[model samples]
Target: MLTRTAIYEGTIRDGREEEFFRRVREELEPLWRRFPGVTAVRVQRMQARDEDARPIAMILEMDFPDQATIDACLASPIRPESHAATVEVMKLFDGRFYHLVGAATVLAPAA
Candidate 1:
């Protein structure tokens, strides 16, 4: 499986955190899920970090079966729609795409 992760690595614009998350939950999520070959979607809101670390406002993860599926989804018409939806909430963020990788580990719960 291949995962495309968009790490929203920044701070929320002044006084816009709640509105941002709300828009993401209500508007952007639906559009994000509309992409083809999207197996799973997750959004993470960052709570804390190190003193010198870049504050990550959010993290979005989309899983696909392979690279081709991800590429196709990126090329699809829905991508523009997704981008538009993103802009609505993007006013609350001030970061960039952190990284895109093919391998990741899932940690199991400790007994």
Candidate 2:
């Protein structure tokens, strides 16, 4: 599988944290779930990080079967809709967000 992760490398405005969370769950998630070829959509609300490192408020992961699937999805008409939703969600956040795609491996737990 291929996974794309987007990390928000900044803070949500002081008083807008709660609303930012709400908007992501209510508005942004639905749009992500609708993306073509996306097999899974995961959002991580950061709780802690290294003291010397910059804060990552959230992380979003979207999984697809392969890079070809991801490419097709990005080229599809729905791409613009997703971009528009992202723009709206970013309004409440002050951060630099970027995405990285790579192969995903699932390991079984050892007994």
Candidate 3:
């Protein structure tokens, strides 16, 4: 199994945080789920960090069977639609994509 993690690093623009999160929950999430070859999608909102200066606002974990699938999904037409949905929320963000990496640990859920 391969996991692709994308960290959307940025702080929500002033006065737009709530709207951004609301759209993520109401709109963007469904679009993310529609991406081809996406086996699983996990969305996380950053709450606290060791450093107060950290600007990361959200982290998204998308799992695929391989890098090829990940690449294909990015190239798919749905990707642009999903990206457009994200852009609606991104108007509230001040940063950019931080990283994209394959997972080093594949952990099983605790029983």
Candidate 4:
């Protein structure tokens, strides 16, 4: 499996945190779920982080069967739609976002 993770690094505007998250769920999530070949979509809202670490308000993970599927999804028409929606959602945010694609490896628990 391959995962494309979007890291939203920065602070959410004061008093707009709830609205920011709400818009992400209501507006962006639907478009994300529609991406072709997407196996899973996960959104993480930061609750706490190391005091010295850079602030991260959210993280978005989209899983696909492989790199090819991820490429196709990114090349699809839905990509633009999602980008537009993301711009709207970012109005309440105060930082930048970027993506990292990597292979996923799941390990069984040690017995």
Candidate 5:
């Protein structure tokens, strides 16, 4: 399995925390679930972090069967639509987002 993760590095604009998350759940998540060939979608909101660590407001993980599916999803018409939606959602945030793609490794627990 391949997982693509988006790291949202920054803070939500002051006084907009509640509204920010509300918009994510109400707006962005629906569009994310529509990505072609996506097997799963996971969203995480940061609660606490080490003092020295960079501020990460949230993390988004999308699972795909393989690179080809990822490519197709990225090339799909949803890309532009999602991008525009994301830009609207990001207006409440004061940071940047970056993505990482990696092969998933799951280890079995010892019996």
Candidate 6:
């Protein structure tokens, strides 16, 4: 499987934290779910990290069967639509967003 993860490192605009998450759940999540070949969408909320670490408010993980699926989704017509939604959602944050794409590994216990 392939997993594309986005670690959103930023701060919610003052008085916007509640609204920010609302849009993320209501607006942005659906876009990620509808992406072609996306098998699953997982959203993680972070509480706290090290004292001197970048504050990552949230993490998004979208899983696909393979890289081909991800590439197809990226090239699909919905790309522009998703981009627009991303732009709107990002307006709630104070810093930049980042992403990484890689193969997912699931380790099983040895018998």
Model 4's alpha-carbon lDDT is: 0.94
Please list the residue runs of candidate 4 whose C-alpha ends up more than 4 Å from where it truly belongs after superposition. Answer: none
Best by lDDT: 5
As for model 2, its CA RMSD to the true structure in angstroms is: 1.5
Q: Compute each candidate's TM-score over C-alphas.
A: 0.86, 0.90, 0.85, 0.96, 0.95, 0.90
lDDT of each: 0.84, 0.89, 0.83, 0.94, 0.95, 0.89
The TM-score that candidate 1 achieves is 0.86
What TM-score would you give candidate 2 relative to the actual structure?
0.90
Question: Candidate 6's error at 54, in angstroms?
Answer: 1.0
Where in model 2 is the C-alpha error above 4 Å? 108-111
lDDT of 2 by residue, 13-33 (tens): 889999999999988888888
Candidate 3, 45-68: lDDT as tens digits: 887887656677889888888888
Candidate 5, 1-111: lDDT as tens digits: 999999999999999999999999998899999999999999999999999999999999999999999999999999898889889989999999999999967989999
Clashes of each: 0, 0, 1, 0, 0, 0
Best by TM-score: 4
- Listed per candidate, the RMSD to the true structure in angstroms reads 2.0, 1.5, 2.7, 0.9, 1.2, 1.7
| Candidate 5 wrongly placed segments (more than 4 Å) | 109-111
- lDDT, candidate 1, at 40: 95
Model 6 pairs whose backbones collide: none
